[model samples]
Target: MRNTLNQRRSTRQHFRLLEQLLVATILLQLLNKPAVPVLSTLLQILLLAWL
Candidate 1:
């Protein structure tokens, strides 16, 4: 139905936003300090949970 399609589109947009956020976080961390795997890992876990 149209509602289901809308939901799917919204979910996809959320995922895209999250992916951009994750990339930005990683880039910021790398620029601000040495590469920290823990933060990135935690973010990944959080994103997975969100999905």
Candidate 2:
């Protein structure tokens, strides 16, 4: 039972890390593109954070 709990904990941690990386990558891409307006970018960031 303890081993199972540890496994689940590790899996959750991994997923959270992946989610953060995905958000960062998307934000970076948006920043790199010159056409994205500031309001849209802020909205996108807020949306991602909400998720």
Candidate 3:
């Protein structure tokens, strides 16, 4: 019974860690947009010229 409780606690901790990681990834993507969005848009325009 004690082992089962420990397992549950560990699983909850893992889920919390995953949630934090997902939030961090989303925040990083948002932070990158201002720096990269225009570059990507320009690249798309160049690609269109090629096709």
List lDDT for all candidates, in order. Answer: 0.78, 0.67, 0.63
Tens digits of per-residue lDDT for model 1, 1-51: 999999999889888978886887778786885555676776788777876
Clashing pairs in 1: none
> Model 3, range 1-51, lDDT digits (tens) per residue?
999999889778766765665565567567875645555565456446544
Error of 3 at 19 (Å): 0.3
Best-to-worst lDDT order: 1, 2, 3
- Candidate 3: how many backbone clashes? 0
TM-scores of all candidate predictions against the true structure: 0.65, 0.62, 0.62
Local error of candidate 3 at residue 43 (angstroms): 28
Report the number of clashing residue pairs per model: 0, 0, 0
Which residue segments of model 2 deviate by more than 4 Å?
A: 33-51
lDDT of 2 at 20: 81
Q: Which stretches of candidate 3 lie over 4 Å from their true place?
A: 33-51
TM-score of 3: 0.62
